[model samples]
Target: MSYVSRNKFESARKHIQEESGNLDVLGPENRSWWRQKSKNKQFNQSNSSMTVETVKQLTKVFCDDEALINKKLPKELILRIFSYLDVVSLCRCAQVSKAWNVLALDGSNWQRIDLFDFQKDVEGPIIENISRRCGGFLRQLSLRGCQSIADGSMKTLAALCPNVEDLNLNGCKKITDSTCQALAKHCVKIQKLNLDSCAAITDLSLKALSDGCPQLTHINISWCGNVTENGVEALARGCPKLKSFISKGCRQITSKAVVCLARFCEGLEVVNLLGCNNLRDEAVQVLAEKCNKLHYLCLSGCSQLTDTSLISLAQQCPYLSTLEVAGCSQFTDAGFQALARSCRYLEKMDLDECVLITDATLIHLAMGCPRIEYLTLSHCELITDEGIRHLSMSPCAAENLTVLELDNCPLITDASLEHLTSCHNLQRVELYDCQLITRVGIRRLRSHLTNIKVHAYFAPVTPPPSAGGSRQRYCRCCIIL
Candidate 1:
């Protein structure tokens, strides 16, 4: 307190030196300017100020315990070292001395903090304390999975940490629209926000964010079922600079929302509408038409999406690299043919359960997208040895293809494996439920690509039920050949 005046500092030094052998901390080089710093304290150190006598009294207890090398360092150097410590360690260091308390709690040392590891221990009181201490110096704060945080905690945080740009409150179940309203009211610098699984937040929260945080580039409201078109439209119009919008499992989101977003946020680069089953071809078409820079798009489980969506993306979004259309069974080889001709940068494609695709799809991709690496065709029952032959012979398969999944493609046989033996870059292949795939075929493929892992499964034929008896059935066989 009060810069630990020379007289008291010396007295404490003598008192401490009798019990322990040193008064060398707070080195002499810092003595001259230390007095003038009494008037130059950072932010308001009202709560942290302590009387010189208080520090002197504590020195007796602390000196006998252990010396802290950090305490011997200059305040500037001490704070620089504290910057790398996590939140818990900082709290403990603050208890060592009044000088150390000031160094440990310096706002600059609390710029970015992730409290997910201490979720159960984090609560409203602790958050408010951090908000007061961190203030404008805090740029990012992640309170994800800290479910016990109270409804008012985030409101307090938004008010105090006004300059925070990245805030993640995912799975903080108790927070509602009020928290977002507070954020909209105060935190204008917010750029990336994740409110995923914050179930109580509805259209009101989105509207609040839209009206205020115009700089937002990334927003995720996944599983927030109550969000719909009205909220998204406002968000799109207000934050035209937005680049990523993830609303997976938001069942209420439909074509109206996607169209509104696509129309306004033309700069969007990544859009995930996964499991939003109400989304249709028109919405995806609009998105592909507007967001030409689109790199990753996931429409998995949007069953209403047909070939029109894929064709639209192929014709417009030439930058497309990753696309997931799992469970959208309407997609056929015609859509993929167009995709291959346009999106040459395509790398990962997931067509799980898109059963209408056959050998033609693989041929189109193999001949066009030389960068294709991960291709999933689970349940694409029409894929046969002919498709594998075309794929294995392609430069993409030889140079870039890493993983290929053909599970439940019953038409694929040992011949398909034989065709794939030449894909030297291949890493793993899945053949579960491919009833005609034999172990010998896998061995042959692995002989060429020695490090490749072939995941295969086989089921024994079910014998006739034993008369008047129930017996344990043989376990299914799963092997990585």
Candidate 2:
């Protein structure tokens, strides 16, 4: 160990000796062994706490002392810190004092600005101030959830953040195709962009993005109702490096878009099409064939998809780990069986509202996907005590399993809760809307699984009769663990 590590080890040993409390039990040999062990552990944790303490001290010294606060901070450090601070915090810091205001408003420090929830009426002032403060150093900008950000505001931002790489205008209700045109003209280096939930954006905006941001890797246009397969095809043609794409709730996109993505963007790892109600088994087949590197896939609310798509996914994508087919009501026992058999390395699976699934599927899942850690079966009406019992008795039951959600599964009872007590590593369990689960079951779980977080929503408990025979005493409990 170096000198610094050795000193840290000595300090840790002293701390352990002071805190051990049973000094009388330490024999010469035992004491020597513990001292050596403590030294090793302390060396591993060397200077981490000290570094944190130093940063805290520096922040306090800089923020408190008037003389130092007036002195200009290193331009590089100011820009670095400003990039991390959100727009609200940046604006607040500018009001600290005259010197800080100047530093905060400096052109070099305004690299990435996030005006997410800035005032609606002050859009003009906000844009003017930002443009004046950040001459050309602005690179990344996000105006997510900003209701006041119109086409003009977007144009100003695009003009200012010239070298912009990432742009997010998610839920910017006022922005239209014109905004995209301005962005294409100004921000040529845009890579990761999110126009999610922007209803006004159409194929025109997508065309601009494809034409301008050729190096784009990640794009999220989820809930943009006007974007269709044409837009997606255009994107696939222009941006070959696109890896992560989320078009969830985009009902206009069809299997054609999926095929285009598979044929063009071979490097995709994350794709979320949740609530794309039009997608069918053919889309999944295309994805499985082309996007073999995919790790995360969300087909939630794709009601048209059946077991065929899931079976194809399991057979084709060997690296598949996280799968969310929530609200895919057509999935049956056969789908789960195929998933269990082929996708053995599955880590997280959400089968919420898959009513056809039962104990047999759960048993197969437990036996096959031994590495499964997170499972959600919310609203799975077919899931009963048998399924819960089988899951609780699986090899993954004792350990590894950390999160489990069984909300609205009425068949789950106190017995299932008792079975879960053996899962010592279980961190979070949601039993919301499981009417059969009572306080007794919760108390029993707490007894064995001391560290586990448990959530139980009780709605069936009867109210006690009032003494005055006027009103009944109601008791509702929602425990979050």
Q: Write the per-residue lDDT of candidate 2 for residues 195-287, one digit (tens) a residue.
A: 887899999888887888788899999889999999999989988999999998999989889989888998999999998888889889989
lDDT of each: 0.87, 0.80
Against the true structure, candidate 2 has what lDDT?
A: 0.80
List the lowest-lDDT window of 10 residues for candidate 1: 60-69
> Which pairs of residues collide in model 1?
none
Task: Measure candidate 2: CA RMSD.
Answer: 13.3
Q: lDDT by residue for model 1 over 1-481, one digit each (tens)?
A: 3554444645765775566446544445434434444455531254444566445545634542233444454668778989999988998988876767888899999999999999867878999999999999999999999999877888889888999999998989998999989999999999999999999989999899989999999999999989988899889989999999999899998899999999999999999999999988889888989899999999999988889998999999999999999999999999999999999999999999998998999999999999989999999989888998999999899899999999999999999888888888899999999999998888888888899999999898788777886654654553322
Highest TM-score against the true fold, candidate: 1
Per-residue lDDT for 203 in model 1?
94
